[model samples]
Target chain A: MTTIAPAVSGRRRTKSLGSLEMGRPGFAWAIPATLFFGLFAIVPLILVAVLSFTRWDGLSSPELVGFENWSALLDDPIMIKSLWLSLLLTVLGVVIQTPLSVLLGVWAAGHQRNRAILSAIYFIPLLLSATAVSVLWRALLDPNFGIPAQASWLFGNGNLFGKQATAIGVLAFVSTWQFTPFHTLIYQGAARAIPRVLYQAAEIDGASTVRQFWSITLPQLRNSMITSMILMVVGGLTTFDTVLILTQGGPGTDTMISAYYMYEKGFRNFEFGAASAIALVLVVVATLVSLVVVRASGYDKMRSTLEGM
Target chain B: MKTRFTRTVTGTAVLALGLSLSACGSSDSGGTGASPAGEESGQFHVLVYGDATNKVEKQIVDTFNKTSKVKAVLDTIPGADYQQKLQTIINTDQAPDVFFNWGGGSIAPFVRANLLLPLDDYIAKDPGLKSNFLPSVFNSASVNGKAYGVPMRGTQPVMLFNNKKVLADAGVTPPTTWDELIAAVQKLKAKGVTPIALGGGDQWPTLMWFEYAYDRIAGPELFQKALDGDKQAWAGEDSKKALTMLKQLIDTGAFGDKFDSVKFTDQGSPTLLANGKAGFELMGSWEYATIQDFNLKFAKNDLGYTNFPSIAGGKGDPNNVVGNTNNFYSVLKKTKTPKAVGEFLKLMYSDEFVKASLAIGNLPTTTNTEKFLDAADNPDYLKYQFNLVKQAPSFQLSWDQAYPPSGIEPIHRAVQQFFSGQIDADGFIQAMQALPAA
Candidate 1:
């Protein structure tokens, strides 16, 4: 009843202020951004959806093919395997990065001077473009000339890219190294925003540090976790530059994730229609995953974890 | 809180949009004139692959522009992105009047789409254009008996390159026959060196082995048949024999265990040879230039090359060669300045062109190229390639370039898998059979 009372008064206040032109900014302020988004994002997406139904190589005029591309994709063994690989890589990213970043983010959120210096050094990798990072790691892992040659006992021929397991492992490892800092920054900001009084109260209750974190810090980071996971999901689904520079979907298409497979199909094979189909599937999956995460986590309700604190 | 959530959703949407956006190439209008071949009023663009060799192309363009009223503009896309970018713009109004390509499957789609101007008329106007180049090389750009391109760059026939000092230390000589090659490999292996430095990671380097082996065992007709939609050609006895021979080479530890992780583009395999870790490498003629760029002393003195060893009873001619035939400049159908384009192409075989090409270590296919051979950066190597190309009965285009671009991935995958023992003879055959028809 108390929560509902403020909401009813807020609606009345906004309505009264609306007549005096003192409420929220009018929809006109959003027109430019809306137009830009519509032109760049919405229109292209609609066109791609239409293109998925046509059979067209780049040189020829597109012909209406109905559901031929979709049906062919459904039968494509590589497409199925690529989907599984995408899922596996995404799961690996979330599983490995979530705890790691959370801990690092919390630690970096401290007031220690040394922590600031170390975190700054840790963020250097995040500054490099994905292509640069991938190229650096590729050189470092070269079997005959790189670190592998100096430590043959540990590397054993350094066929990291020659086998499927190791190729995926490399992709996951490089991406984690490149992206963990970014998610850590998100958690760091969120951790700073967590009211310090909650900690004080927990301390007075004689709670241990780990207990305080489990009960207060973890619960308070629920919103940040959802935001970070959604980012990881989307980024993982579209992981292209690393895979291209590192493995190139090689070792007999073992690491052919969906995004790269789409590129190979569209650009290399000139099967634009099939590629568009794959692109649409990626979009739908990413959107649905994000939506489900938001819905399942009760994120849309915007309930405050500190509601009665 | 709502604003933050909205921003996150918007950000996710943007990321998803990027995937589909990249799937479709940019359709923005280019800065070039939109009018269809606006006569002599505007410049006719010439797009070539961007690389160190571009200086020769630039000089040629300047020489062309000196006399021509409809001036030529040289545009370049970086080497790696050239093919993809060309495809994206080839069908648009932004398409260049003349573009460089590997010919064969590279320009086949343009021909099928009627976007290419057949060069037969140009050849008829000036018979020198057709007769100037070697017929074996000239026919590479022809489609269905119609001439479509004029050879612009040097031929890149794959040859067996060796570390001469390493071979000498191992008491071996460059092999001339299949038996001798095997014997040499054994000696090199026994000498505690890898017999060959293969950049299997690059995939295309591995394809070279399959290309020469198939040509040796089955002749150029087999690949021609396979490319012409005869899938059974891959399943034939000749194809199996070629695959078996390649498997034998791999199993003999010819490429060593780490070949799959070494790449030629990154100086991996080349370093192996230069360091005497390996004895030989089968590579394109440009390998000389590539090695010269990195290890000049070794390239100048120790570099050795020979034709791929001949198989005794093979169907292929002993003198047959397989590699990139040469790059060609194909004119688009919409060019209004056909007269200017013809005059520009005439310069391709001019003495100046030949001299400049040889100066840069490129062996021009022009008949007059022989006269300029002595002035080349490396006269002996240039003369050897020129003589080899001149006497070769058939200059088989690489299998990847011989088929449409769609076939590249499958061909590379099949060869790489065969080398890595991931696939066998039957599996390799099936992969080849599945390639898109030429």
Candidate 2:
């Protein structure tokens, strides 16, 4: 009892000491970080925000015209369409990818051979650089002499990229194809950490594989599922490289998204000021969408748990 | 202590980035500089659009450097990124001494910004430089009655290139009239071949068909007026007729259904012509040399050339040419060595430059080009283009190049939409009228 008293008192002393130092007047440790953030993050953000109100050729002094760039957004049909498409891709990507990843992950966790072969196949896409994937798919989907064209009996006319409906659909399919495996790997990790005794006990009680998965496997994987959904929303909103190389927003601007539109404005048109405006607007939209995703999808629980840890 | 170290590291990185952005921004937004000319003693850099034709440019620059104490250094930017890179660097102190340009609208903005050196004084001292080239070709690079660019390289008149074996297989000769061209499309389509190879994937190649059609039906005056701010000209009866003909060709399946997927930049369209899968391709004269380099047998035994067909009773002369009349070399206002650069301009009209350019498949527009036609790689092909250029009553510059940079993409998009049946005649006219005029 005497030994325990000293240990408790020592821990209390350290706690009090930490609280005492928190009230120090100087910001010696914080000053460098604050200044660095002010210089890089704050300064660049303000520059972009200010430039959005101007009209400038990239090579000349910007001419200020307040709210003009913002006003132009209303008349710009392509910009509006791009935003809607980005949101659609975000929602659809999560809905499609989550189920596929969860099923594959549950199935692969059963045995060593199943895990090895399925993991190898699923991980192959993540290994490829975005550029190589885009070009390879372009050739494979070529309407003249490619795999789809040769097997036209299955893929009507092999001109899937020509029609607007099919092109956007195919774009979503390609995105899901490349990204579902990552989510699967996350779910599999979570599955491994689950106690084997829980499953064995459920099986002895005559619970089927599907019933055990529904009651035990799913409840255990809730945190990983939420994490993956948030990541997917962020990634889907910013899909630039794959789209740029594949269609180039073409067959007459059918597949253009916000990122590509921003590029076209800045690089192709040399209208840097307007492009900056588009970028800031995109950032704001993404933030709001992400907030809604987190609140609606139980991400607060995971974040709070992390904070507590 | 650990927190302090991390803060310092981040602070340094931020400071570095801020300094970098400030430095790059000044040059880009510099507008114009106060200083104009530089000393004319040392070597001057000349930037060219890098492509297959750069071989000829290198030889000419080498010959000039060998003779003059003030030497010229050559730099090439890959063809795709040339324009954007030039715009970025031209405002900086690192601006090229002289640069390749399409003249007219391509250099108009630079000229307006006063970034170009007007060559009028140089022309006054050297009469031969102005007089040696054809007036039409020389006038291509002129703005407001003052010459801004010297005729460098060669003329590039767009011509109807064909596969001789493909045409023979279909039992059709090269068409000389609009009706005959339509008939040949029908014959070629019935023979199970893609009648014409079009690189619609690259937007500029799609514009050539429109250039020839508009020039043949409405004449050069129509586009000249349209360019001069008569937007109503786009809605005129003659313009409607030309658009109708293009629609007819598309409907008859002259270009295959998959042309929108093929590209000239990647050699896809050329491959079709070379492999005898297509009967015809309307392309720049450079196609002859390109086909030769890629597939020697096709260039030797099967490549064919002819003028764009005349539209009967139309407003144009049958011999009117359309395409890049010639590419030019314009002087930068910030050149470190102006006098030496002017001396180098004289070499463009020199026999050595002409011969080297002709040894490749370039059709030099010099008045003395006639003397060296026999030295051309394919002399017969050279004679055909030479006669075509010499006899042209008017050479309509490709609309995209002739129009300002701002208008190029809109023009390309409208044409693509029309050809794909996305827009009608009135829709196209509205799009063209919406374009800002020079």
Candidate 3:
């Protein structure tokens, strides 16, 4: 009864504060932030949405074309193929980066040997801008004379960037190489925060290294895993600079993913109306995909883990 | 605690906005001119495409600034990004009063949008302006018979740049006919050298082969027909024959296995030409200067350039030329100092300008340029190009630059695909046929 009385009073005081928020100084202070976001973010988003239904060449005023751009974009073969490739890339990115980062993070965080040096080596890719990394990879993968191309004769002498399969594969590998370090750092931080005393308790219980990781480390790092997965999916959807520099969607549109296709259409083709439609479509898909990832990664399970801890 | 957290968040957000606001405040608009064109303003901006010739442009601007009341400020956007940046800023507040352009269909959109000033009025004030330049070159800068641009730089004509020593080693002279070219290709291949160094990765370099081959195949009329929206012209026999001839070269392995990965802009093809690896590279006349900068001895002793070979049965005159006519300076309609810009352009044809251009290996388009040919870095090369252009029955501008700006990418893509064998001749024809009618 004593505990229930304090909880009930606490709830009453929170309700009162919520009701009085309109008059509060904090709420007044938040107005500026709200207004800034509304002006910069919301307005542009609405403008793009409106433009998706118009025919605009950017030189003149936009003419409303009613659902023509959306229908045309949906009917485009290149857009369809590019959209599929985008999804495939997103799936590949999440599937590849998640497990590898978790493994690396756990190994570095849990192991006492050379952890600092090893993590730093893994972080070198994160230090390079996407443009630099892309140009480096392009030179390194030059079929006739690149060091990697010459050395990889053990595979075959087929041109890497010119062939369909190898082009996408090399680009994906380059993207993964650059971004995995980011996810690893997240997991490393999460692993470090899992309470060393719990690990000590498991050691006393005669738990093997792998067993301890499976039991405690993965569970404790659930939120970080979900956060990293959502981030990577969004990033993969928006991937541009690296692919643009490396390929420009060459070898006959084999590597043209959605964002790049949208760019080609808007900037190169002067079809901003069609590009706007593509941008809105990508946003919707990214949001839905993020929601799905959050659910599948067990957002409820993560909340329960937090509560139990 | 919650109140303290809100305070920190607010402080950080305010700090971030303040920082961004300050960052945006950089790039101050140069001194103001609130009056109309010809009204006295202290300064005006002139944007030029950045290249090896930037020093020459800078000298001209400096000369203009020394005595003129309205000083000219030079802004240069680097080579590859120039066209893209110009597009974004052309309709904006930051657009230069006078800007560089390729003229012709390249500036067709600007003219159509009423954003470019017709220079007829300025030309009337000084008849020497139009009369001082070559009729052919100057006419290219006109849109619908009204001058919108002034020829400001050298002419660019595509030529077959070669390594003389490599051809000599194979016992093959620079081919004057298509049959001889095939024979030379065969001889060169037997001697273990790539017959042609094609930069398929850059794509535009590959389009040179198409331009030359098409001109040699069906003459300039067919290309003009296609550009004028004759879909039937693309399906014509000459177009098909042109594609077939191009395919034959690709099938012969004249470019070798790795040509698709070699890029011209990154010195791949040029390196092949300067060394003994490739016998020939069909490139602009700029190839001489570019190679001379790196390997002077090879450029001076072994670099050989000649006209694109004539096809035996072709309807085109053997003297027809193809490439860029030249670069031009166009005035924006909103310029507040048209008279000043016109005055500045008068220097384009001045004897001082011709001497400065020749010193840099550029072949100026001024009719007075012929008299100054001996001043060029290589008199023989300059004379050869000038004669070729002057005697030419027709001069076909490279199709990519001749078409609307938005149309260049697809054309390059189509040419690259044709060279790579990714698409058949029908696909190539369809791509060309799809270009927006000029």
Candidate 4:
């Protein structure tokens, strides 16, 4: 009995009560949450997945066609084009918005005078709904009486950048304008959380202001940067409302995103099976990219490191 | 711990309760269910595509509700989104008992799906209906000899609506021929006035120009033959001439430089004529109602409607007009109380409905509707409609609604591209020729 008590006590010494107790309430809370998520998100996703394997035109009973819809998506040229466009937009949006947002956040954070006013001004577009933004940009980009055309005329460039490039640029620019503010707020919060001493330490090491930003400020904002980039990628990939309202995937499908194409296929053409397949492909790609982003940012490593400290 | 558990349980219960309530609400309101009591008890739910604020549709609906045995409930969706919404409802089997539908290609999908109740039986039983409607209008609703809808109005292609004051100021009467029209437009152009009010922003209106020009050059037979897949070239010599003439008008700034930015339904085109900024507008008979809605006034004689004049030495006839049966009403196949729907249809085609419709400048499809056409006694302007229908040798459906969806939407896009100069005359012809033959 004495030998067994010593062995059990030795095991108990290594396993802390705190570690076991920490997640008990979480498990208790997770039951209803899991039920809710199962009912809404998981169940709907499964239904869509099952539907993707079927040959149904939204009106009739769905018949399982195995991998036919997936194969059809692989062969569809328009679907391929739309996928490429969505990817390009997502990459461009993230590439442009991240650094711009970080810079804006850093600038806005350091400046005390009129900080609130500047923040509000920067956030106005974020406050406007997507529909309103589309309408406003439509007027601003109108070839006849628009500000862009007027500027082009004043400067003697036949167009702002020529017709095709002009439309693409406008779409990318509007997307960035609408989303950058959200990222700015995220980065600003992250940047504000970093102790002032880190920048001071960088300065003491003979680093310039830009060097300090690259080293201290940016590195500290790693998690937020990853978060913002993921959001931007997902948002850009799923963009429909702005494109539908503004261009309707037109001036010749130059700005047709995957989401817009799905909407057209599902609603306009009533090819729900094809749309579901496209949606599944989008989800898989987004999920894989999100995993890579989270891993690369070393979020798991950071949490462990913090725990160790 | 007990309090936390109680709070969690209560929250879950509330959420569950909410979900159940919402589910109930959606099932009752959104899903396919029995018609409302009013609809079951001889009331008709009439869904229309037009301006809800327009007194014309309201007056007709109100009169029908008051005077007829069937009560009317009118739900007006905006013209642009109406078709899409109607299609969704029809597909879901939540369609209203009676709803407005465009007569030709637009209704073909519903007809083919068996979503609409064929009116052949109803028409046969009610002999008066067979005689009441014009042959052309009746034919528009018939597909392979079975009627699926009842044409309620008449439609025509863009005609020249001249602003008498603007033309007089430019020292010109309404042009009688294409050359005279061009000369008048040129005269108006020289005076720094817009020659024509063109709403190119709405791609359909822009396409109407192409259709009308083609009809005027190639005639209806060749055009129908082209749609029927008998012709290999849309850019035939006649089509080329039409495109050249259209391009000439475009170059002459006949449509204002900024016409692409204007919305079609905002009266941007008609405003040019009404405000005396333009001499003529290429529009349909429906423009009379639009003009009246906008509070634009002109003497009945001053507002002249003329066909797009013949191309000089063209193979087509000068007097031929592009026409179709206008919006029609269809009963749902799933209606439990079809008698109520039939009664509503009766009221819709009744004498009072015809008179009210005509009073608002809409030409009724009913034969002898001309008797109710009081253009002289009333402020309504339907003289052009009466003249066009009476004088036409044959009427062709509007290109947008003339063929099946597979054939129609692509043509609309092609016409817009043609107008936008993306495709040349030959290219336009080749592209249209490639459409699957009807």
TM-score of each: 0.93, 0.86, 0.87, 0.79
Which runs in model 2 stand beyond 4 Å of their true positions? A1-41, A104-111, A114-118, A303-309, B1-41
Which tens-of-lDDT digit does each residue in B1-438 have in candidate 2? 444433443343334434433433453334332222234447888888888888988988898888888888887877465666677677766677888988877887788778899898888999887999888788878876789988888898999998899999999999999899999999999999889998876778999998888888988988989988999899999999999989999999999887777777667788889988899999998898778878988898889999999998788888999989898999987776788898899888888788888886788888888999886778898999989998998877788888877777778778777876778989989989988776
What is the lDDT for B281 in model 2?
Answer: 95
Candidate rank order under lDDT:
1, 3, 2, 4
Give the top-scoring candidate (TM-score): 1
Model 2's lDDT to the true fold? 0.79
Q: Which run of 10 residues does model 2 chain A get worst, by summed lDDT?
A: A300-309
The positional error of residue A249 in candidate 2, measured at the CA in angstroms, is 1.5
CAPRI band of model 2? incorrect
- DockQ of structure 4: 0.10
Ranking by DockQ: 1, 2, 3, 4
lDDT of 1 by residue, A1-309 (tens): 235435645666678678778756789998997787777777777778989999888777889999999999999999999999998999999999999999999888879879989999999999999999999999999988899888989888898889998889989999999999999998898888677777887899999999988998888899899879888988888788899999989888899999889888888888889988998888877777777777677777666565654
Model 1: residues >4 Å from true position, as ranges?
Answer: A1-25, A201-207, B1-11, B18-24, B27-43
Which residue pairs show collisions in model 2?
Answer: none
The sequence of per-residue lDDT tens digits that candidate 3 reaches over residues A1-309 is 235435545666788688788555667787998787666545555777898999876666789999999999878888888888888888888888889999988777766778889889989999999989998888776655576455765536546666677778877889999999999999988887666666777999999988998998998888888778767877787788777888788776778888787777776766778877887776666656655665566543455243323
TM-score between model 1 and native:
0.93
DockQ (0 to 1) for model 3: 0.20
Worst 10 residues of 3 chain B by lDDT: B25-34
Candidate 4, residue B434: the lDDT equals 66
- The list of candidate 3 runs beyond 4 A from truth reads A1-29, A196-207, A304-309, B1-44, B92-94, B334-336
Candidates 1 and 2, the one with greater TM-score: 1
lDDT of 1 by residue, B236-258 (tens): 99998998888888888889887
